[model samples]
Target: MESWLEKRWARPLYLAFVFCLALGLLQAIKLYLRRQRLLRELRHFPAPPTHWFYGHQKLLQDGKMEKLEEFVEKYPCAFPCWVGPFQAFFYVYDPDYAKTFLSRTDPKSKFLYKFLMPCLGKGLVSLDGPEWFQHRHLVTPAFSFNTLKSYVDVMTQSVNIMLGKWEEICGTRDTGVEVFEHISLMTLDILLKCAFSQETNCQINSNHDTYVKAMFDSSKITFYHLYSFLHHHDIIFKFSPEGHRLQEISEVLQQYAEKVIRDRKKSLKDIKNQDNAQKKNYPDFLDILLSAQAENCDSFSDTDLQSEVNTFILAGHDTTAGGISWLLYHLALNPEHQEKCRDEIRSILGDGSSITWDQLSEMSYTTMCIKESLRLAPPIQSISRELSKPITFPDGHSLPAGITVVLSIWGLHHNPAIWEEPKVFDPLRFSLENSDQRHSYSFLPFSAGPRDCIGQHFAMVELKVAIALILLHFKVTPDPTRPLIFLPQVILKPQNGVHLYLKKLSK
Candidate 1:
């Protein structure tokens, strides 16, 4: 009996030792192969290096936009180069190349955007082919003209809440106030009211607290994933602190979203039982989303519903909020321009309690201001596309499959070749006569073509209403102490926030 037991234990121990030895050897081989590949790649395209084996890492670490621009300009057409064993892109600034890659119909988005797959899942933005088509069809109805009009009251109420808060804080007189945080909160409230019928006050509170803090952490994690080693295909999340934080935030945010979704679903179920004809009394976007059930019901799933809710919350709140913040910041800096915008608002509404759809259409100058603000400080600063199939641009340069391309707003918007005096803030450039002479893609703040922003109409309405109300109440002036600086992160935000004084205008 003793001899048999010893024999069994001996075999198992030997196998375990062999397994350990094999793993170590495999790791060593992988390291050697990676080093060889890096050296081979470096010979063709030489990347600038840093001392101490850092190799262009400091530039990445700094995250300064100017430094990044310099890096882009160093290479031909601002293409990003790799460093050492890890393959990472630096910058891509060619417009022809951008159109070729981005316009391609493929699942090529996965290569560069692997980091977002976990957070966004297989939602419309992250999908391709039939799955993307089906999902987009189902969700598009939520943002339709009639559907959007239903939420106008919610938008008005949210804006009213913001104006009231601003009045209370600034004491109904000429007082210095930063508008970024207020705009951010106002947009958040509008999104919540329209999308989910929930509300949270984030303006008066330290803009750096709680929700904003969580978002900051998440954005950092997003930036960290730019390195190829930290990509989705690899299990690098296990070793990364940023990845861990991303996961934690995902859990926290999803829980919050799920709670709201559950409540909205319950409310819709109750409403459905009462009356099928009472469509006008529907709750909000959540109600429409829940009721979007089709006869086939094949396109919709529990996962799809969850993903849609998360997408709505993020996109609805962030993009509009960012645009509004930029508009406010610009208005604060240029009081003469602000006066022009106010005059336009007054001409259209004439002290009306709310801006009707017809009146919103008449505010052409206000629209021009918003357009120029977007052109200068577009909320989505960059968009990426990875080449899935070999394609030649209009310039005749062929991009090989499996390379990434980017349409850089930083470069494109500021290009003097496209816009004469591009640095100047001129809303009149958007006038029918002026814009008709420019290229369609030259001033695409909401982008162009099929992949452009879907919520643009909704956002425009919200901004027009909010700006009209704010202009009716106060005259914005920049605080001499705090100059505005654009801090580009996930969105273009003010570094110190938009600090300005408000003078109460006649009601």
Candidate 2:
């Protein structure tokens, strides 16, 4: 009886040990497989030096773009280059490969967009397939010309406020102003007035200005996501300082948006109780979004509403400012071109007047100048796409699936084959007569196809109004000492911030 009991107990213990041993071996195998895949992906890449443990993390600490330009230029059209052990990417300097990647809406090409996922959410920029189609459809109406027109009075109001401040300063001496900072606030004011129906003049804040600080914090996080390939992975992001700051800023902005949305909803409810055309009178984007929400109760949640607000605020504010600043920089350097645009603006609107959208559109020379500025200094400098299936390029080189390809805007714009005398600032290239002869995919400042910028029309309107207002009051001359230095951010902006001597024009 004792011997039988011993054998029974031993049998159970032995089985338990075997099971544990099997699990241990399986885990070890899984880890080994993961490392092996990382190694294999990295082996095909152009090798950068790494520490014994951390890999190429240090190379991406700062000045990432400067290093990346060197890599892209050196390789030209190489596939699957390593930033570190975790990433294997492709760089496409060739126009043909770039076109294929940018135009395709396939599932594979969509994965390269994962970088934008955390910051932008699965918004239109990050989404693919059915989700993308649905979101794109729902959002298209918000950017229509009629909807945009409702916001013009607000844009004009904001510009007048900015110009008032500028006039105060420039009255005494030749005010050497940093135009980027001025333009930045002008667009911010426009976004606030249009989207949230609030006025936030961030240029001169009485308080410590937490809102603008949060905005800069959010912007820094976006900049980090764009270029830091190795740290862009989920694991590294969780531990980053910027990552923590992003969460905080997101919370702050979310709360602020919720308050505005809630207030708007309450106002609409009150209007409904009263009845008639009073409710329909409100024309701001906030009113439009709230109206849509009321009609389609099942469509979007508070999260979605907040995200759209954030997207518009960020997109509308920076892009328009970047466009105007670069245009001024180009015009400042080229006085003949400056005179041409001024002459055109003067001819169309005359002095001491406001511009309507139709009037702005009719100013052909001004439009050409804006188009040319976008060509040379595109606000969004590079776009990245991934390959899902192995694809062959026009040059007959093959790129395997899962490698990222960066479309170099600077390279493409500078390519002599595409544009005549590509370096010179010539708005004439975009004139109606010359536009027909231009290549279809050559000029992609706002990008091309369905995924291009939604706020472009709004941007153009804001630019025209601001530019017209500035020119009416002040004639900008570059200080002879400070020639414009090209400092590239997410937008190609002036480094010294377009220091110009503003002589107030007599009425």
Candidate 3:
């Protein structure tokens, strides 16, 4: 009786083991087929030297910017790079290759942008297909020419407040002042007042004790998580210390954004408030999101509203701050160009403190310098896109579907073949005659094609207003002894804060 029972149980156990083995075999076959297809597509492309385990990821982690620069220079066109087992890229620097990629219906790389998903959510940057188009359409009106022109006053107010502090403190300091510190705060203040319709002065919190601190802390932690080996795994990242702090900081940002949305909701309900707000002629960013919600409740929610606000705040401010700081730096290094820009501003404004929309449009020389600065040090240096479908280039070369492509903004701007003497800080390259000579894809600090930055016009207006005011008031010169290093962070930032000697111009 005991032997018969043992045989009955053993029969069931044997069948279970065999079933598990068959499932494993099937999974192996699927992986092999997928990997084989990818390899076939990538077979002809050349890549930089890669490690067996580290691949090219170590270069990012070890802070090897020079090595990466050398590789890009050597292969100043389409070159392959491996991040890991599945993370491969044809990092393209050639303008033609870039145009081909940009022209297609490529999606943002999910693996590269994984870290940002926690804070930015599925805002315009992450959204795809009909959802992306819908959100983009809703927000487009807020950035119309007439609407952005009105925000110049707000930006001027913020810049004046920053300049007041700079003249009092930084102008008196022996070694000039840290430009990035002051400008970053001012940009945040502008973003809150103009974009969110929140009138708080983030610059007043100079010590960065409030939401400004949260922004910096969270960005740093998220960038760290992006490059970390262990944290690449979501499960592992969740249990890590950096992950914990990111969660805490993200909550602070989201809660702050939610507060703004709630306040705006209350204001919209009041009849008297609506009349006064209508004087601005156009709705702010918050209003657009809320209106989208009313049209189709399922399309945009309170969560989406808060997420986009946070995304804009983070994306808009940090990037512009870096761009403006770099602009001052380059102009300072080239005093002749600085004086010319200042002279142009003076010619247009003629002792006027505030800049009109018409006057802002007429500052051609100043705009050229700004474009040149952006080319040399684009705030967002590199961006990635993944192919949703196969593409055949003009050269008859093809890239199969499901590959990530890196658009190296810095590389294209500095390519010798594309730009003559790429690193010589020449603003004349942006002159109308010279600019028209280059390929459309050559200077893409704001990127190109369908998904180009929507806030670019607004950004240009703000930059012109702020720089025009700064030049009208002060002369900026780079400190010879204190050189700055531009690091590739969430935005390109100087390793040591940008220190420039701000000499108040004689009236």
Candidate 4:
């Protein structure tokens, strides 16, 4: 009787196992069909040969840039790039296509950019629709020309500090210094002073500062999360080591922002302190945020404050540093253009004095070279958006609603069809006569449209100030021994750090 009972139970268990196996097979077949439907929908766009399961991931594993360029050359306007069997997006490089897509009011790609929301906290970079509009409207005044003009002094001081450090390094070492490291810290210093009026001396104490270290770590972790397929799921990533580390880093960043807000709020409670703050040359970004909060506590909460603060801190410093580093690298590689830019800067700021607001516009050639550098190596190589409505490109290609489109800024800038000898670093391309003749969307380092970078003006002013001061003080040349390999992360960072020899010029 016991043997008979065991046999009956085992039969049920075996049946249950078979049932589950069939169910799983059905789900797999469903998923495969859905992917095939997507592929058919994208049939109008050509793609490189892809594996049945791995897609383009294997092809992109080595020499990603070269493969991308190859695709660009073979395809016209846009092509579908599959990340896996189930995921794909059109890699759009044509200026006309970019202009058409960017002109729309589509939200950012939820699948791609949502990864940043945990780190950035729904700031301008991630927000959409009414909420994004509200936040943007509230913060717009902080980046006004008057406020940016007041920031010039702060930028000058920060640049001078970096240049001083380089001076000391030049005295002792005949070798090239890794500029990206110093530039990153200096940009962080500048952002701190301009954003919060706080001086942490990060450039000097960089190795020891936990906040600075956390900031860099957060960027790396975010980039990792973006590319790791297994970590795409929230629950899976939360249990992983990177996720745990990211959580810790997030807490550190949150704590830092909170402390600054708390201190500023406490000081503002004092009437004397408020009066003094009002009497200052101009209020910093934090002051403006606080003022906005005081006016509309219901609209702008502490959470919003923290998000914007963290967003500005991370986005501001890193991107600006990349732009400055690449611009200097390009200038180093092309000394003739570098010398011409120096002459323009020298003419604007005689005796190598502080770069003033009015003089910034006078450095026309310098500005052109900066634009050229941005074109060749845009800090943010690509941006993505999800279509809310079906749209047809100028070339008669169309994409349905809900499709994700990646605007390849790097590809657009380097397209031979849009530019003559695109790889050549020629600043004349940005000259007024030449610029007016080219497509407006051909060069978009800061991107284009309503969602373009809000801090672009602030970034431009900072770039001009830093480049002017550096050019005035040193003759920069590329380190022949350590060639740069472009690596696209959160920004287009060099795989190896940007190494340049800085020879201090006699005053």
Most lDDT-accurate candidate:
4
**Predicted candidate 2 versus true structure: per-residue lDDT over 1-507, tens digit per residue:** 999999989999999999999999998788567556756654544544455444544544443555544554555454344454445445555566667767776552343345434445556666677866766677777888988776666777888888888898899567788777777877887888888777565766714666666765565566665456645666787678877777777667777778888887787778778884464433776666666666666866666666677777866666788888888777877888777777778887787456666777777787888889988777777666666677777776666676667666765676666677777898899877898886677787776665677778888888878877777777787777887666555555555676777778777
TM-score of each: 0.84, 0.83, 0.90, 0.95
- Please list the C-alpha lDDT of all candidates, in the order they appear: 0.68, 0.69, 0.81, 0.87
Clashing pairs in 3: none
Instruction: Give me the runs in candidate 1 sitting further than 4 Å from their true place.
Output: 1-57, 68-76, 81-85, 199-217, 227-236, 239-241, 276-283
lDDT of 3: 0.81
Q: Who wins the TM-score comparison?
A: 4
Candidate 2 backbone overlaps, count: 1
**How much does candidate 2 score in TM-score?**
0.83
Who is ahead in TM-score, 1 or 4? 4
Off by over 4 Å in 2: 1-81, 107-119, 233-236, 276-282, 480-496
- Candidate 1: count the clashes: 3
Q: Can you give the lDDT of residue 484 in candidate 3?
A: 73
Residue pairs with colliding backbones in model 4 are none
